[model samples]
Target: MILGCGLQRAKKRVEVSRTMGSNTGDQFANLGRALSTTASVLFSAQPMEETILSYSSPYKKLLHETITNTGGGSSLVKMHRDLNLSKGKNKGFQDIYANSKEFFKNSYSDSKTTFKVLSYLSDDLLEDVPRDTIPKDKNLITESGEKRARKSKKQDSTLFQGFEASLPVINETIEIQQKVTMNSDMKPITDSESSVSNIEEEQRQEFSLPNHLKAEKLNNSYSSTYLKEAAKSITDNLDLLEIQKNLAASEIRELDIKLEKLKLMRELVFKRVAKIEQHELFLEKHLNNVKDRVDMIIEYNMDKEISSSDDELLSRVSESSPRTGETNEDYETAATTPLELKDDDASPLLSKSIYQQLQAHERKADAPETKKAGSSKKLKDAGMPNRHRHRKTYPTLQQFYETGSKIASFPKAHEEEVICLDFDMPFGTMCSAGSLDHLVRVWDLSKKKQIAAMSGHLASISCMQMDQYSTLVTGGRDAVLKLWDIDKAISEDNGDHSEDTDACVYTFDSHVDEITAVSFDGDNLVSGSQDRTVRQWDLNKGKCTQTIDISFATGPMRSQRNAPLHNSVLLTKEPPAIGALQCFDAALATGTKDGVVRLWDLRSGKVVRVLEGHTDAITSLQFDSINLVTGSMDRSIRIWDLRTGTLSDVFAYEKPITSLHFDLDKIVISNNEPTIKIYDRENGNHWFCGEENSELGDVEFVRYKHGYLVEGRSTGDINTWAI
Candidate 1:
């Protein structure tokens, strides 16, 4: 409508000019053309503004198609018309005639033409013009005598004044936007810079800059709005950058902590290395000292042998050299008789203790009263069994595990399965053999012969313990306890089995059931039996001095079934079965067929604590210190810390364990599979294997003579192996 009015005014001007003259009409024509061009440029800018404002601009596809398919002459106007075409259903927007992806490409030339057209017209209208085109203008300026910067009142709708006033502002704003678009200093959106669209909604409100833009800025230059938006984008990007920086700092702190830990570990490693080095040096010195001692001993022994041989030959020659007062017959008798060595002539090779004892023995032979000192305290002390077990250099646990080997074997040592065995290494002699055969067989290890078999038990011997002077006390299934004089049995050849009660030196038939185990603790004999009782025997009186009922304390073993029971199973009532038993200092730990291990306090005759976990009857038990290992019919061996009455470790097997034993760092277990398994105690790894324990044997450790494992099989095989 504005352009039409401009054209009409231009026509009117022509009429007025023609009335004046032909030269005046051409000036009117120039004025009319300028007005018309400015109006055309303003109208054309509407779609271009829309294009720049929206990413989904109508210009893009058409412009793109035009540039790519220029050979097809696809123009901007043609593309716009096709986009407006309607198709099927509502016959709407999807219908297009001259356009598709194939025809669309960017038309940069068309965009440039539009910008150039606006600039050309704006420059012309505001720039060089003929001086003859204008008269001394009437009211062309505001009442202040300068053109009005803003309208004072509403302009006449019919006049072109408002339209002319809006034109220059539009032109300058577009020019500025174009400059910003082409500027190198105005940063382009970068991939690293967070988009204005992606900033959190809450954050956008929080970091929002004040909206200071007036309506004039929106319609005209829009400089303030652009600047405000630019500021907000910068702030959002700064916040994102700050967040990333904080995350990086946290990671650095974690890395620093890890670095400190590494340094501490390095320090520990250094300390350990220093200790190891010191140990190495000490070991080297020790080795050198030991080498010197061994060499000296070897040299002394060699020299002693040579001197002794020479001395014997010289002594014989001297005996034959008769003195003037001595008869030849007397000299001959002295030389022919054994050369008895006096104290001064004793061999240096003999140990002091052995030599002293030999001298005493000779004196005792001469004076018979010395043999009566058996009851003397000093003599008892002197006769205490040698507890010093001769051992080789103790090997490390790892060395034992990797290189374990059997050292000895004694096959068929008993007629039945040897339930238990004990060693009797008396100070003056060795008679170390006892089995479940109801007889104590004494083996002379020096002579390698079985000399005496002390027999007394009427039933299978269940348990036995060796006392001082080759004395052995045994408990049996017949519920009888018998103490044997091992030396007397060997020297006197006493009848094996004696039924006369008065003839038996020490025999107690106090137990009501089979005696399962026995332990010699100091002066007392602690015995466990199937009668659910542990009796401390008084050897002097030949009777049970104290009895702790293990079956059901304070209750009868068999009662009327309907009677309400006052207590659970205790020491008085017989237990299911006393399968295994062991005695410590003041307590007895007993394993039963009911799968419970009870620890009884000997003084109070009461159960101290009961440990339970096995699902099947316990078969074997071995303990060191307060720690115990029990094997059960459940095919598992569980270790317990008896001090705490808590289970500590478990080892599972395919077969029920029949017997088990352990030392400081090794565990040896025999199962129904007839095989024995040895494990490293700390690691629980299977360390070695042995087949000697096959056939359900009783295994015993011979720690004195040699570190040998002895197993007595049910199949009448006894094998001792080096460990």
Candidate 2:
């Protein structure tokens, strides 16, 4: 609208010029043309400005696309038009066009045409006129720029006047641009000078030193010298530290090697120890086998010697018998002498008396028969029994009791406590010990080692006895009796350390309670139990032949159901247990816990007599054909004549008697003390056979035969003292 108003004013001025002269009208015409051209150029620049601004501006397209995308169903053209119209005039406005590419092309063409038209007009207007024709004026400046050092020149022509008005402003802009260019060109020099000054100030402050210090001017050379020295010293120290580190590493490697060697040595030592232990075990097993073989060899030699001796004696007997020159029956009778002696001496005595009576009759009838009988007697005297050779001369039991010392101690007789011990009497070569471990161990007294270990009893063996024929009878707390063949046990033990199979000959479970005492003579075995009964068992029958109930209380008798030997005898209504039992010939002597000794006739099974002299329980008692020896916890040993039933002798001790056994000449007694006391019946001498401070323990059982006294201790030791 402003351009249009300018054109109208120019047309009105042209009419006024036409009314003036032709020259004035021509100048006005030119001025009008210039104004029109300038307007046209301004109008054409709008499109070019939009093109440049849109090409450079990210904000405009972002705003347009954002609105276009965000408007959803809204018109895309309407949103783009609104974005175009919202750009402020400062950004230069463009006419609404749907295609920005077509708009950009049309704007480029218009800009080219506007530039050519301006150039063509500028070519005509920039004619180089004479300097005197152009006027320099000051009043053409605007009133607001009064402070301007320079002003526009006035011109006669209107176009020249407008041009001259803008010239000073353009020149002012040019000058300001030149000033900015000059400052930019001088920046490096100014910055370089300022940095140099800052450096000098910093150096002056840093090395200013303190008062009273005097030195030459500080320079980089002095600082560099000390820095080099410090660097050299640090490098030297680093080298030394590296050398030390290398040495330390070497030492660690050597130590590791040594540790490996030590580990190998330790492993080797452990292996060697294991090997040695295995070898020791092997040696121990081999040693046991060797010992078993040696025992077998020794037993074989002893048997061989006995057989050889028997052969020699038979030859002598055969040779000597023929010299007597008797009939076949008489020779047969003479040949059976050894057999009759083994059974009983009575048959041999009766036979000999009959022969003597016949010889007396023969002597009365003929003198030749008497001489033959006397010569036969001399030959019999020369042919002594072979058993006499085995008999060795030894001190009597009294002499042994006085001078005997513990010649041997067998500690490992049983694994448990020894409760009872018995020897194969007369020789005392073989002895058996019963222990709490339910095992009976037999030891060879001559060899001093265990020969057999017998296990059969279910409970601890309370009492045991070994007869002359190697027959062992053991009674246990199980109230059962077991018969063990000592010969079989010894033979089986030749192969192994323990004998189990066939070691027990028989187990007799007849008693109902613990068997306190047991004794056997010939075929009859008697056992006394806490059941207040005495039982007699037949070895041939393996059954109880008789049970004598001693209790005065009237009750059902388990023994009377069996065949009764005789009428029963009742005594002691308080019921005393038979503690001590001894069987000899046809009599059974039982001592009750009440200290009364009863002699029962085995043929009648009736108490023949009761001997009551003991003040305490009878611990042990033994009777022969003539005398009865009884030892009691009352500390007294009483000797009573079996026929009279009267106490004949009383020997006292300081300690209570534990066990006692007597023969025709001497009585051997074991008391609570370690010693075994002996009383010589013929010499009236009494002595002990143990040390005063011996470790014999409490003697549980004692056996004295020949010259040796063997006592079993509760400590599982069977100690022997011999003279």
Candidate 3:
């Protein structure tokens, strides 16, 4: 019972130590169990030995020698002898422990004897027990009794002395540990608090026991290391995800840069090729001139009657050079004979055209002489462009002016005067117009209806264009250019022609001033603004990628005595803005309000030439392979030879030109006189004409199906005509 009580006390002490963060409590607990187990084994080993001995009190001295070892009782007795047990205390403690266990056991098991045992083991009975076994100096009450129960006072040494001796060694080890660690402030650990701190760190690093024992340890306040590992793993995964996302973004950026570079390179290559082709055409034309001179020489020496012309092959008076038809008889005989003339020399005699024809003949030896109209051997033989030989040139003065027929007209095509127009797309019979009403209107020639109206500009719509597929692009005085997806109207879809168009695919608002003109050169958009800037936009990026400052490209503004007025005010000084813009292969043609038409190499941003003719602000300009035509408020249309940079011709108009339309055989002039007139290309004679009953804003000869006209008028209407 005493052992059980001591074990319960030790258990409670371990709980308190664990709470205080002491790890050595577990070792103490193990030592206590070992002692309790050994004592119990000793007591059970000799249970009946004492009883039998007392009963045979007569033979006590003689029975000692006669007793036999039972269940190794001799070894147990020897163990007790070697233990150095305290003499009186051992006997007293054993008796009290046995009495307590018996009393407690009987009090619980048998109600009749429970009271007797309880009284026997109570505090009164304990007071009657021997009191000399333990010493009071060692904190024991029984040993300090007034009588010397044991004859020797020095024999009462205690286990507490040994326990006290080991404490210093524990403290020294703790001090050593303190020297190895740092404090919260990172200061050197000191021996003053070493014992307590070392015990806490050791307890925290301790491991729990078996599953059943770990139940209590799990409730400990300190968190386990596994929780930190889990959190670290999650953080690592997040970091990895961030790295992957960044890499993917970098890859996409690289692809975009590569694509943009490729587009620039493609444009450059195409321009170079076009230049090379133009040069070849020029060289070929010069070569053909030389060939024609040679042909004239061949024709001169033929057997025809010759007028008295200069001669270099004759002596003073005889003029006895070889006969003019001297080789005729020889040519006839040689042509009939198999003469061994060199094929190489003969090849040089053939014209490039003749050479191609012979080669084509050889390739299609079995083909019939008949041919397709646009692409045919007959057109090649006729010395015409095989691509469009069947197509007629521009109408004659009589055909366009006197013979044109009215096709269709829209009386209310826009809310205000139309300002700009563009055709030449494959729309079959449709035209697009921009107006001062800040809207873009689409008119169908066949149906004669306003198919759609696109509005986004905050100010007047200054310029409008349609791409090859009839995609609409418009720019306005608001400095904004918008690209629209108008495939619905272009395709003539029967589903929803009445619905208003949606927002533009791209809105370019980079210009700080009004946008004067916008044009598409292939997929890229070039826009000139009153900000004195021209920007090239990438369709894929929906943003400008290049800017050209034309500040250095202007010519001196020519003053006019009688320039036109707008809002009853005479235009005075030069406008520091781009008024007209056009993009071609590797080139940008910009006409400012100063009437100076400057052609810039768009890629290099360098001015190639400045064409000066118009005396007032440039209204419109057009360019083909051969000539540049400019119309202005000076009431004049000037044509410049593109090759020679010289003014080729000039025509006077009755009023300021609103627009100029150039073709291979005609130049259509539209002015503020409410009339559209046509002129013959060969003779420059005015012939056919039309009337809007108001100032004409713009006009365009229909593409593919020529002689058909779409006109934009000042009174907010569209008119279509035919020749």
Candidate 4:
């Protein structure tokens, strides 16, 4: 029986042993499964832990206490539950757990290790295991909870007071571990056992730990002191980066501004260069023109020198009479005698003395011959011959018109008529035409001849005048005021006969339309045109100096737009007629088609007065020392007091007076009628009359030194009478 009991007991012991081993294996499997589940739960609950950790200091303290009481392994479950109950209440419990598992798995391997460690301790030691080894059991049970509460309170105080101060050291240690794992030389932890081995190995070689670990330990000891310094460093670096960015932006802006300024400067330089080139070209052209003008002046002076030498030679031939039967050489010797430059060269005083001697000799040579009486000194000029015998017979009327009418009959015929007969000057001459022919014949009663045929006018000559240099200036419908050198043309014909007739010494092309009248000061020539414009021409330079518009009083003609016309005639209303142009000392007077006499101050180009009273066009105008006399188409002659611009007298004429003149004693007026009448300037009384004629154009008067009056008629007739 004993033997059988022993065998049975042994079998029973083997069976019990087998059951225990199976139970232990089952428990290990269960523990491993539980650890795996815990690990998954911890991982899934990572976001909840992070949310709790990110709270404000006081809130984080409460959360840390809750976590410690729940235990590290179960904290994730509790966090998921609490989060679901709080703001994340919409999430399903299972979904929350799943997401948390993913989060922890990505974040940390420690989560799985911690759960596995706790599971192994619980399976091996059962209730005898330390509370910390089985953190979930201890955290959940009421008895261990109290201990955790007390520990958590103490931790809370430290956390609130100094947790921030330890964070840097903890981060530094974590960073060191990460660096070791990332290094190419380091081996990876392949299994949990290997991880555990590595941890033990790390602890054993503490003295030979990596530089990162040593740095971490030092950081932990000094972290609280360095926290503010590290923060300050980060902020300073940020500020420096911002400063650099701003400086770069400012530099870009400055570059843009500089580029714009450079562009403008380049444009200015180009303009300056172009202007300089233009100025250089203008200077070159001006220099060339000046050179040509200088050359012309030199050539003209040379010609004058040659002409003066020829005159001296002719004067010597006239001064010395040649002997009869003299040889050609003898005559030539007398004529070629060089004038010696006298030492006491004709003194300035001798020039005047010589003129006085010549006048005295003329008087003696002109003395009448005396008849001798019966006795020696008989009645000293015995009674000059009968007054009738001494009387010079005047030419018959027919002879005056036949032989004396020739234009060459006048002395000094080479000179042009400077003053018109209508002017107030004592020697002014008038122009006349018997037919509609465009011929203007000027007669001088002093010399009794046709002085000039003022031609070159397309229409009937309307007005004429002369400048200071005796240039025959005429204005007509041809839109031109020509300055003719009557003397030069005549002298050229008589002397060389090769000079061109079309050649004018000087010409002005200033008037745009028909030249109505032309007058001159000593320096400037003034012309009035049908275009209602007045231009002042510089006589010496033969160019226009200024032009003034006068169309304000009479509006511009619309028929003529901006078209340019040549010297061709166009039909318009009876064309403007210029009655007279009178120039005083410093003023100019003009009578126009409107019968108004306007006066202008030449120096200032200002209108002085408008003399108005005539009802018809003023045909002729004359000015005396005190009065201005005007003959008009109204068949009357009117005189104006110049100083006051008032009418002094009006004399009725039988016909419209066409010409007027003031002869020291009377005013003479000529019209188309036969008779020429003279009126006294003071009283407007009829003074004298000339022989009748069928057609008369103009009349003029001549004053003699011996008080005689001479008259010239347009029909080539002249008469002289005592004043």
Query: Quick one: best lDDT, which candidate?
Result: 2
Ten contiguous residues with the weakest lDDT in model 4: 379-388
Minimum summed lDDT over a 10-residue window in model 1 is located at: 330-339
Candidate 2 runs further than 4 Å off: 1-402, 426-429, 494-496, 553-576
- True-vs-predicted CA distance for residue 487, candidate 1, Å: 3.8
Report lDDT (Cα) of residue 156, candidate 4: 17
Q: Highest TM-score, which number?
A: 2
Cα deviation at 445, candidate 1, in Å, is: 5.0
lDDT for each residue of candidate 3 in 376-474, tens digit (9 for 90 to 100): 232222221111112122222212233466656777666665666665321133545544465566655444675666666777766777643345678
Error of 3 at 169 (Å): 99
Clashes of each: 34, 3, 3, 7
lDDT score at residue 522, model 3, on the 0-100 scale = 56
TM-score of each: 0.40, 0.43, 0.40, 0.37
| Better candidate by TM-score, 3 or 4 | 3
Per-residue lDDT of candidate 4, residues 483-573 (tens digit): 5554344334433234333323444556656665667655467787777777776543345667756666335542434545442222321
Please report, in order, the local distance difference test score of every candidate based on alpha carbons: 0.53, 0.61, 0.55, 0.48
Q: Candidate 4 clashing pairs?
A: 43-100, 43-101, 43-104, 44-100, 44-101, 45-100, 421-429
Q: Evaluate model 1: give its lDDT.
A: 0.53
RMSD of each: 28.8, 43.5, 35.3, 41.0
Ranking by lDDT: 2, 3, 1, 4
lDDT for 257 (candidate 4) = 100
lDDT of 4 at 25: 37
* Candidate that beats the other on lDDT, 1 or 4, i.e. the better one: 1
